[model samples]
Target: MRNILLLICFALMSSFIQGQEILGDWYGSLQIQGTKLPLVFHIKKQDSSYSTTMDSPKQMAIGLPVAITTVENSQLLLEAPAMGIKYTGEYDHTQEIIAGTFQQGGLKLALNLSRDNFTTAINRPQEPKEPFPYHAEEVRFYNESDDISLAGTLTTPEGLEKFPVVILISGSGPQNRNEEIMGHKPFLLISDFLTRHGIAVLRYDDRGVGKSEGEYATATSKDLSRDTEAAITYLKSRKDLKISKLGLIGHSEGGIIAPMIASKSKDVDFIVLLAGAVLRGKDLLLLQKKLIEEKSGIHDSIVNRSQEVFHGAYELIASNTKTNDALKEDLAAYFKEETNNSINAAQTNSLIESMTSPWMQYFINYDPTTALKEVDIPILALFGKKDVQVPAIENALALEKLENKNIEIFQMENLNHLFQESETGMPNEYSEIEQTMSPKVLNLMLEWILERD
Candidate 1:
């Protein structure tokens, strides 16, 4: 799961200036820990009054109401009290930019908004240009369990009479077949590389995303496994493709689901888990929060306090004893007391709603060990040494203790959750890195799969 606190705290920016064109969309990117998060400000003038809203495109949040907007002496100030965000800027007519600073809590970053919504184009050199080598097909399959149609791409080598096939399971969020994020299409590249190497690859949009049908916001990980099962069924039905072996290559939460299916299905021959969690979901999220905060240079005391707050909240959610309404009241009272009533009811409600969501509740309590142990098929689990979200040390050690003869684990050094060669292994550097995935990791996966084949 993505860090809810990080997203909420950083859903931030905006600006305007006196005597200049400011009644349009102004765009800029906030540089946080070497990560570029783009924000847009929609400004309009209404009968001698000015109003504005903010958008954080990177977070998929738009039209966030700005409580206050004002301009005086050619300087513009905007504030969103609910989110504790403030932006101050001055329009440089010659430069055609609103040069400013964005502040939220103790964090502040330089932001420059322009009429032209242009940021430096992120280079994705690894993305495939053309597809002459492999046969690529846009396909649709039915998730009969959910009564949803899922769309995806299937690629296979040209000359193979029968080919080994694997379904690519994306990590969290509503991803398309490409599993596109931060301008990186890891799944598409994986599909391309493996198909070119004679493995048939099937990757699809999440249930409610892209061309697929169904709702997404309410679905949990177990719900998503049904989609993967559907993909497996679809591949099995395509007997003309002559599949030699079937496997699953899952990243992050996908790693969790792969075992869930492989444990029950007789058809799965192998499974590859990338940064799968060995710790229970609750423990994993706690570790993730601490590591990310420390890496981002947050003070120790603050991190500890935040950890304490979330730990209690997760415990409450995990208890599963209260009705939804009762849980909300309890959570509201708990948060208010924990924060010394500094947080407003709206903020508390937002926190309560997110923590109590179907996905969150399921993830906090779900343990993959049972499924991992039951899966007798060959398993390859890889972790990035620098991955803070699913840090390798504890999880890798946990898997090692499992000592399942069928399970093999490896850790790649200096890599992040996305498997990109990273300096700090923070999510901020994902887009800045040009390589989609480390060649070493990719080669290892290929070699491992082919050897098993």
Candidate 2:
């Protein structure tokens, strides 16, 4: 799939002058096509130089302030090491607004700033136990794509007879080859286990992610599908490959992409869905809101407000609405209501903007349900009962809608979004828990691969 970033750039310019009290929270929405994306800049000015943070309400953990190094003319740049870099917002003195420019691979817009008070939480993904059961080597391959050759690792058994090969696909959100999310790298563990169990596995970094080429923020998951199809085509061309059968396995968003490739391609013989979605992404996000409320340990009133904010932002994105002054106001009001007595206003506004960015808008508009039901290959779908990221309970129903009965479903009772154990469904439980992949998932996948025709 081609990108739509360049075709959808409106005005996102702002004006700022010297000797001004830039110390305050600046808020505004970035526009991508018809949708309005929200964003916040918590500007902390200390004399001539200053530090600021650009954050997303959707991603609380990545909300750390970034140091600003150089400022020349109207352009201002901010760099946050742990996450990614952001270049946007012009200093505006005429309007007293720190206007939005380009962020998260979207258009530019101006933000109004005022001396506002707020608090924030800084989070780094915790390390967790390996997901797969066995040990395997990590290898990289590069080729295709005009930007950079895609790179991926190969995991094979110790003895290495040409064994059945399985190529892993990650869900969404700029994942590494291991599909690293937070602390757990499920693909790494899965490849380790499957290869050691007499299977060959290949998992790669998404293009523009991890040692791969291309700009990630400007790409789509459909692009990843094309990448996966390339990986499969590459494997088929190799003489090193063994066995008569080939397989494709995916987790979360990867699960959705797996089916897309299998449907059109002639090579993929078996498929595995690890917490894949069956519903439209927009609906799935609503379910995600509910999950977030439960996980955040919040009240019902707060939950309702959050839903409104999420849906409103979603409507703007799906319809590709032009972000105007009114859109920004609607967002700020929603965040104010949601964060009242809960999170700091600045932080809340940050989250709101981050979720509505151009790329995020597109992600929510894409659905995997239609594709999941169309793949004709043998499918093994697994869901942890505790999984909140891609609620298995809701996805389980999609199996009944498959075009054929070739799909097999397996649901594990205690697993959460990361396949980590959680009795009460709390996210912190993942850090407290061990073994991100259930032993049962390994057994089921391995057995299915061996038994499939």
Number of the top-ranking candidate, with lDDT as the measure: 1
What is the TM-score (0 to 1) of candidate 1? 0.84
How much is 397 displaced in model 1, in angstroms? 1.1
Please report, as a residue range, the 10-residue window in candidate 2 with the lowest summed lDDT: 1-10
Clashes of each: 0, 26
Predicted candidate 1 versus true structure: per-residue lDDT over 56-81, tens digit per residue:
65553445556666778768787766
Candidate 2 residues 249-317, lDDT tens each?
888778878988887888888898888887777778787767767566668886787677667766765
Distance from true location, Cα of 223 in model 2, Å: 1.7
lDDT of 2: 0.64
